[model samples]
Target: MVELVVQKYGGTSLQTTGRMAEAADRIIKETKRGSQVIVVVSAMGRTTDDLTTLAGQVSSCPPAREMDLLLSTGEQVSCALMAMALKAGGVEAEALTGPQAGIITDFSYGDAVIKEVDPEPVRSRLKEGKVVIVSGFQGCPGGHEVATLGRGGSDTTAAVLAGALKADRCEIFTDVDGVYTADPGTITGARKYEQLDYESLSALAELGASVVHPRAAAAAEAWQIPLVVRSSLTEQTGTTILPGTWSSCSFPVIGVTSETGLSSFSLHEGADRREIGREWKNGLCPWKAVQHVKNRLYRIVVRNEEAPHTKSLLSRFGGRPDTGRALVHVIFRSKEGKQKAGSFMRDLPYTQDCFMVETQPHVWSMDVPERHRVNICQALHDRCMEKEAAPISAAH
Candidate 1:
């Protein structure tokens, strides 16, 4: 039986006609190696953002259903272009929308969850020696009505398809070569990890690492699928994420990351926390409660981009929200990790300016001014990651 390889090309890899041609050539080379290739593609560079801006211009608050309908087209355009590029290269290929490829999801509109995937059609196409080009991030529920997955959902789409099809491997081609110890854009000394465990990668994504989507990591982990994140522009080896166990005390700090575009809100003690939580869940907004003072206040953090919607929801419960905050986190593993994190925070250049500094078992998170996010991240990376003697690995 021929082996199967599932690959996803990010927006940066398909930003232009030349890039798409290059990507097509890359895929053709893989086919020449005798493996069936299934390609998933995101929108062209900034196309999703451009569409969102256009939608906002038409309406202050567009309906979620219509937004999904609008946003899904971006991926469709990419898929069609990629297929055209492949055909022009003398390769057999067919473009498929999410629904056409049999991706079924819930009716959550802007942030739908994939309920199931039917890969029979895709498999049939592959048997015919045709490369299957799939539009990532959007799916149909009940065989009708377009619904889009949340941000970076194309990653999820690729992972799901790989798992369902029982592919040999899943490759995510993006701008960067691989997952770095810290965001390479922020830290000059940040090094790329040759391999990573699913847990660590998922944590990085959830905390603000933009290399791979968190949901995609979770799906890959759940399916026990092997994933390679690599650069499409070069022949870099890239990073591999899979199941593994490690035990080493020499490595503690793995990476440092920050999330900007944040807003903090304080809910009074008498406010219904349950109701507030429910509202966020129902709206599919990402958030976290950072601190809860004894019968005084509850400090909640949410994405600044979602602040307007969050505020509108909070207003119904008489809650006032404040924006313009950011969070920085240091990821480490050690018996005394919390203490080490606290000491590190105290030594920072602007400890006094921090609104809050808290330590979990393996993470140290601090709330700071939005303007200081990048600086804080760089500082943490310099003091922690760059100076560390050993690479990040779990204690045995």
Candidate 2:
């Protein structure tokens, strides 16, 4: 038989008992396909949120250890429910928490990374020909320190399992059909990629695609593990993510995706502010998109002249006046910055369908989707290269 396949089902995929049953069937099917199966799952949909709210009810501000202990229950409940469902289906399955599963990590509550995973117990269960269902997001590694993968860490959990088991592929099942150009919820014509390499998908995920978590991609790529973003809704082919390219295609526009909760800022106090701008890099929005076919967008840094004026601008935009402990040191997503979005998008494919694409002047805004940016940008770049080639060719 082939090596075990590490499969991960997200919160949405395991929202209900019926959904869990469906997922269990899928896991069983994979197990019967000569693939030893180890499954990882997150808490059911909204369960974590509900738990947090419940804890907040008891204490307006709960301590981190208590928070970790409270938050960890959602995944445990899910793991147990899934195991029960699997057993009901006449499949012998065992559910294990991150602690019981031997997922050891540094002592950090609420947000922790996996330091190591001892798959001995998992291997033993598989040896007895039983399927193993492991909790995905929360792990208890050390004393009183329950570590939870920060948002979307379940994907990281699955990748870690795949690496530990030496699995050939890690299948992540979600609600969507597959990874698309833009979020299907926003753009109807968003194209679906048949496949992508780990690098490109990882870049996409880093930029803003929540389809896969960056930490998970990093782990999988480091281990040279293959991951596929499949669907729980159907048995059809999902997008395949390899370490390299898939077959060729002529789709000029690869895809479209957007980042909500996005805030833009401008820094303009000094000239050549690269050094100051560099410090703001951590809060930089990393996602990119292909708007359509003709242009590209890039992120740049904006700096300001005076700290006082910058602080005023930030305060005007609902930011606290305290600059020392702010997430955004510079004022981004200010009213002026928001107003300039239309003009900025005009030059990129991202604004291809803008109200006045041709009318607006191009301003060097930091927010540009990498793919399908303004088509006119490509036209300009192409024209510049052509002019350079023409002059050189004529001289030759």
Candidate 1 lDDT by residue in tens digits, 1-396: 688999999999999989988999999999999999999999999999999999999999999989999999999999999999999889999999999999999999888999999988898999899999999999998757899998899999999999999989899999999998788886777888877888778878888899999999999998989999999999997988878643343556768888878887766667676666566567566665455465443666777777777677666555676777888888876655556665777688877657553424478888888888888888878777655643333333
Q: Local error of candidate 2 at 70, Å?
A: 1.2
**lDDT at 25 for candidate 1?**
93
Tens digit of lDDT per residue, candidate 2, span 1-396?
Answer: 477788888889999988889999988788678878888888999999999989988998799877877788888888899889888888889999887787887667778888998889788998888889888887766774677877887898889988988988898898886665545554434446666666556645754568888899899888888788878879967777766532232221232223333222332333233432343344442311111112321122122223444345344334322121111100112244334333333454434322221111111222322333333333323322221221111010
lDDT of each: 0.83, 0.62
Predicted structure 2: lDDT: 0.62
Per-model TM values vs. the true structure: 0.89, 0.72
| Candidate 1, residue 103: how far the Cα is off, in Å | 0.5
Please state every model's RMSD to the true fold in angstroms.
3.3, 10.6
Candidate 2 TM-score, true structure as reference: 0.72
Off by over 4 Å in 1: 246-250, 266-286, 292-298, 305-322, 357-361, 387-396
